[model samples]
Target chain A: MSDPAAVPPLLDARNIACQRGGRMIFAGVTLTIGAGQSLLVRGPNGAGKSSLLRVLGGLIPCLHGTIDRHAPIALADEHLALDPDNRLEQALAFWARMDGVDRERLDFALHHFRLRELADIPVRMLSTGQRKRAILARTMASGARLWLLDEPGNGLDAASLRGLGDAMAAHLAAGGGIIAASHFDLSHQFGTVVELDRR
Target chain B: MTRWFLPLVRRDLRLAWQGGGLWMPVVFLLLVASLYPFAVGPDARLLAATGGGMLWIAALLAALLPVERLIAPDRDSGIFDQLLMRGISDEMIALVKLIAHWLGFGPPLMLALLPAAALLKLDGAAIMRLELGLLIGTPALAALGVLTASLVAGLRGAGALAGLLILPLAVPILIFGAGSLHPGSGAALKFLSAISLLLVAITPIAAGAALRAGRE
Candidate 1:
């Protein structure tokens, strides 16, 4: 784990406003998270939770706001994001190559998420929980400082949920930041929750 | 700009080969050429006279075949979103995809032209002119195919719209490429090359902007 004191904060958002499909979703939001910190975005369905993550990920622009980040970020939404037809290992390996993740770290990330055994299977074969873990492994493998997860605990069983929790703890211990949007109560681990509403 | 550019191309080529119906365009080109003789009643002289222009039209239509699925699948599946999060620009992704698309369809279309020419009863000189015109023109077709796909990929009825969008952009290439078949028409070939180069230059930028807009 990297030392939090030595590492800079991973993300900052000030006076943020977001819109989707020509309507405003959230406005006047502000937050900052540094290394080893987590920001939990809590919102009900259609409350723009996913849209906020997309905006922060820079896939869409924020209507009125500013965000600053000191390091690269990773995102794992409901979508697998990996190539569906390719073997899971091959698909993850492609991102690993692009992300410059070393062999040792990649192997460790796979092991951490219990995906090492399913690595050779095609992504289309994985069950819902397994696919979720695989996507998490991809984010972990990148070794990015900030992780924007739309729903980190959607299809996981009890064991996998605990596994995800442990992984987030470990990531924070290693000076990474997390901004997760979930209806589930993960505030104990995340420590700071920002609630959104339907409007 | 990452070391992933080559790997990206390789992956796309494989997808185009295995999942993308890579041979469909070439097959369509052949089918269109084959229909020509039957429609014109198999008069060798008549087929010979009209064959080269018909082939050019077939090639233009063939270029449109791959447009519907070109960018829509990857864009819908979150691949581009993932790539964007990793700091890869849409421009780079579009450029690599353009190259891969050309490699997948361009050479195969040219190769199939030989048998198609024979089917049309084209003479050696006509075949050579057709081949030269295709060689210079297909890259532009490939570019236009991708550029249209990017623009229409996120829209409803993208497939139907893509055909309508690409036909107009392809008119210039068709005029020059088919025109080059006439004797003493070297100027047409140069014009075809200029049009092709312009298309090649503009597609990446336009497609990149389209991709970014589509995400919203």
Candidate 2:
């Protein structure tokens, strides 16, 4: 268990609303995630699952409400969030540098994610699962307190899924938090589940 | 820090270099210039007089072609959103991208212009002037191109929109780039320099603001 008195809530979203293409996608969505807590958002396609993630990640504006972050946040949208033309190592290095992660941690992350051999390969050549592993490598390497992941499990195999679970557990154990939106059955691992109704 | 800037630049440059074969704009620029003599009836003087303008236009078009791809790949792959989440300011990302574009397209296009200049029968002084003007002016064009690129990065039909948005803003550079090869070369050169410097100073702010707006 985390010391709630010592660690603040990683994210606080109040009354958040999102509209896309002149239509209300979701409204009045509110949630809070604290250290050692993991929240999963489940909904049908186009239920604004990705929109909510974007809002929480600060990639898009929420039509209403405030999202406050207690620490740096890392988001992995449906997009791999990497430069496809760049080599895996180079791409992750750039992310690590941007997130202020030290070189040692980055190396450890690459090894942990089983990407050490393919580090020099351009991302375009990597398979979907490899690419997702690279993206996951970046998120874990980022060392951020709040993680906003959209469809994080899309390309993972069983082993990689276990790795993802392990990463989440480690992050939460270290006073980090996760807010992931997925269609998969992640309820057994996550601490809380928020279901969004179709708009 | 300066250290961060160098690595970013180096990595981007390497990627751009490896992907050099994918540059269709350079091929298009050469092909268009090669066709000009045939289209204009082999009039050396006329070609010489018009060559700088033609090359500048071609360079602008070619430079603009890749701007969308520059940011789109990052945006599509989710690296862009991650960058923002990591707390690197939008301005830095924009500036780094602009630098990468300049290094990737600007110098090679300038080199390719020599062959185009020869085919157009450009005199020595005119070639010197064209090269110098493009050297300074292209960076400014690239800077503005990046600004427009960031704005329309994820928008539909962004290629045409990029042309529309940047061409109007690039008028000053085009005017001076072409004018610098004429009789008023000295004055035009100064104007080009001033514009380049001004753009260098202001482009980051515009790109930074646009990036922030897009993120929001």
DockQ of the candidate models in sequence:
0.79, 0.55
- Chain A vs native chain A, TM-score per candidate: 0.93, 0.93
lDDT of 2 by residue, A52-120 (tens): 988888777888889888888888765666667768898788778766679888998888889999989
lDDT (10s digit) by residue, model 1, range B24-126: 8789889988888888889999999899999999888888877877898888878888888888899988899899988888889899999999999998999
Q: Is the docking of candidate 1 incorrect, acceptable, medium or high quality?
A: medium
Could you tell me the TM-score of candidate 1?
A: 0.95
**What would the per-residue lDDT of candidate 1 be over residues A34-73, giving only the tens digit for each residue?**
8788999998898888988888888899989898878899
- lDDT score, residue A56, model 1? 83
Where does model 1 exceed 4 Å of error?
Answer: A1-8
Where does model 2 exceed 4 Å of error? A1-7, A85-87, A116-122, B1-3, B21-35, B41-47, B212-216
Full-model lDDT, candidate 1? 0.88
Error of 1 at A197 (Å): 2.1
TM-score of each: 0.95, 0.85
